[model samples]
Target chain A: MVRYLSAALLVASLFWLAGCGSSGVSFNGKDITGLMPDLEFSLKGEGGETVTQARYQGEAVVLFFGYTHCPDFCPTTLTALAQALNKLSDQEREQIRVLFVSVDPERDTPELLAKYTAYFSPRVDGLTGDQETLRELTKRYRTTYSYGEPNESGAYLVNHGLAMYGFDRHGKVRLFMRNDQPVDQIAEDLRALVSIQ
Target chain B: MLHTLYGALTPYIFSPITVLLFLLAVTAYLVGWRRLAARGRPPSAWRSLSFFLGVLLCYLVMHTQFDYYSRYMFFVHRGQHLVLHHLGAFLIALANPLPVLAACAGDRHFPRLAAVLRPVRRVLFDPVVATVLFVGLIFFWLSPSIHFDAMLSLRLYELMNWSMLVDGVIFWLVILDPRDPDRAHTSRFGVRFLMLVAALFPQILLGAYITFADAGLYDVYAICGRAFAIDAATDQVLGGLLTWIPPAMMTIVGALVVLRLYLRYDSEKGG
Candidate 1:
């Protein structure tokens, strides 16, 4: 009985290992279909109005987490995203929404977030929430954020995720865009995402 | 102060299953220990302390705010596994709580359940199977793609942790069975030594690979964000070292314990 059981376990593990090989439509960005939960959040929008993911039910949503005080990666990533959006056709652009969720809610008020996002693109909408709500949203995506120690001037930095999550029109998670991904490739992936039924 | 303490003690992601299983185990052990003491066969105080301490360490790492850092930081994740799969599990198995646990099982209740589980336990405890599982799990989870997915999915993440703890306990139990092989028909000491040595080298190699790699191998930590502002390379190297050195030392300690057991049994038979 022991020998048979061990053999069965061996075979089962082999099958599991074999199943790890992924195959599908290849994109420059990592394909995350079914790997993450669907897009969902109830955050405070630019005007202090409550915004839920349900508001963007019929459009593709690209979600990013950062702070207005982020001096480097946040602006660079947002600019790259803006450039990517510029490459898309007018109608294609209309089908996508870029959400810049601020993780440093203490320093990034809704008005500041709105202004910061406006400098990037019209497709971008700024969002922030209370720390608890932001924590829940980040945890749902398997991401996290932390604040660094304040400097003598009371300035501090908030570290956050450097990837963008793409959700389809029907709110299924589809793509994982790394911060290092090229703008044209991001655009191409977004175009493909837009065409997905 | 009390409120802050409570916040730190609370689980970052509460798992009812973990809490329930831990409660059941502690309750059974306590009940069985008292029963044995009444019968004049109580385990030593040192053994009891080891058992409780082991369980407590595992619980603190798994159920407290420490779990949050493990999720977001590479080095903390390695430290968590080190406790689960090496230190904590090692202490629990070294305590040899089997007899006490069996006392709880007794002759009256769960006979059918014990009978059903006997074959499964036999298979898991087989020296070859135990060694393979002990080493294979490390490699399987550390594989970059699998690591990425496991860290992302809550169910898979929980499964990964629980499997490491379960497999670690089983492997150590096989090595640290207090019974003499000749009389108790337990696994041979030589075979147990072989299992320890076999499990050691692959871990060393994997650790070295991660530590020496120029580029960051685990992008998941970066993508998900880290717990602090430490460099990614520094975190990876620290995690690699944690994976490399302490576990190898534990294996050596385990072998020495096995050698002592062998000598004790030998002298008992010869004298």
Candidate 2:
């Protein structure tokens, strides 16, 4: 597991890691052995470009999986995550990143994901792609998601578990914050994990 | 702030010494929530709240100091009284059965306290007991002789304050018994309104009493006015109105709101 994560980190740093954004570390684009598996996947962006795992390597990341049409859990989790981030002092908090991954890739073009994630937190980075890529990423991340047929409004929803992964600066999952936990605790946990020198 | 109230160490059932104690009492239910979520654990919220409240009471009694409010406007000081003792403490009791005495019956005090607190609980939990205590509390302070006596002794004043706070809480706890299955609904809005009503109902009557009462009451307060130094009668009425209005509106209307919410929740659940 450890090597797998390290490999992902190394490979991801190749194309991205530009302006690691005050997180005080940058991926060498060299995969570290015995860590996270390398996950090179194609994704859509609002302005029509490819987003890959490499884009987020070496940054402390908060990753959540859901679609744009979620009713309760998605919004609640996002709101809670934003609140947790808000609890910290600006400097300590700014050294973090949030990524939204769309499980319902069939309809969740990168554009939809980007717009949806933006509603909750400006720091959020949304990534979506073709069906195969989304499926592979979701499976690797252990994200639980299921799709429902489109309803009358031509929009269907996906029910997904609201779990967030907290990654270290090295792009390694360090802590798991459940959606239902209090925001203060979540923020504290995130800051503590990131502050670990 | 904790330093201002001496004998704050001696919690006295209502006025706890430290904010830390208050936090503990407030967070007790979180333990129960976890238990329910995991092992189907027996509820420890009641015990936790009781212990926390006891800690506060002990802190208050040991270090009771009134310097902070004593320095401020008298009304604000009294407002503090109506909040911590009367409202805040009661809300804690209703939300969690800080059945402090009921739970940790000290081995030594077991027979004695039960003998004492049992009747007290029976009467307190009863509506008639509540009404009488509530009425008696109103009149006791209103009477000049008793009022003067209360002012003369800090202990007396503190005792009355504590009693009123506890009695006030006990009164509503019985009225809006959260433990009662029929009254308790598993709805967030219902619970919130339940809290609002429990707080508001008493205020309505008290507000009415002060708004139109003919005679001046409470010589201790009338003679010794606090902030903005109004006349004794005016202060007394104003105090009554202040006490009555917000809490009453919160309690009754809040309850109805809760009932509406409860119905909605039931409809949603199709139960």
Candidate topping lDDT? 1
Worst 10 residues of 1 chain B by lDDT: B105-114
Q: Tens-digit lDDT track for model 2 on A1-197?
A: 44344434533452132211222333211112112233345677655688766776656777777777778777888888889888888886777888777777767676777788888887787777777776556545433345566778888766554557667766654554556678877777777656745
- The list of candidate 2 runs beyond 4 A from truth reads A1-197, B1-74, B84-86, B98-119, B180-216, B221-237, B253-270
Q: Write the per-residue lDDT of candidate 2 for residues B1-271, one digit (tens) a residue.
A: 7664444433322334345544554455454345444545444655455435643543343234332222112233345445544555445454445333333443465678778876555545544445555555655553455544444334455555556566666655554443433454323454454445444454566656655676454433322223233444565565666666545543664366346645765776685
Is model 1 an incorrect, acceptable, medium or high docking prediction? medium
How close to the true structure is residue B140 of candidate 1, measured as C-alpha lDDT? Answer: 82
The root-mean-square deviation over C-alpha atoms between each candidate and the true structure, in angstroms, is 2.4, 25.6
Chain B fold agreement for model 1, TM-score: 0.97
Tell me candidate 2's TM-score on chain B.
0.55
Task: List TM-scores for all candidates, in order.
Answer: 0.94, 0.37
Each model's interface RMSD (Å)? 2.6, 34.0
Q: What Cα-based lDDT does every candidate model obtain?
A: 0.89, 0.54
> TM-score of predicted model 2?
0.37
Give the local distance difference test score of model 1: 0.89
Per residue, candidate 1 scores C-alpha lDDT tens digits across A1-197 of 65657746764774373333222456788777767788989999999999999989889999999999999889999999999999999999999999999999888888898889999998999999999999999998989999999999999988899999988898888888999999999999889788777
lDDT for B246 in candidate 1 is 94
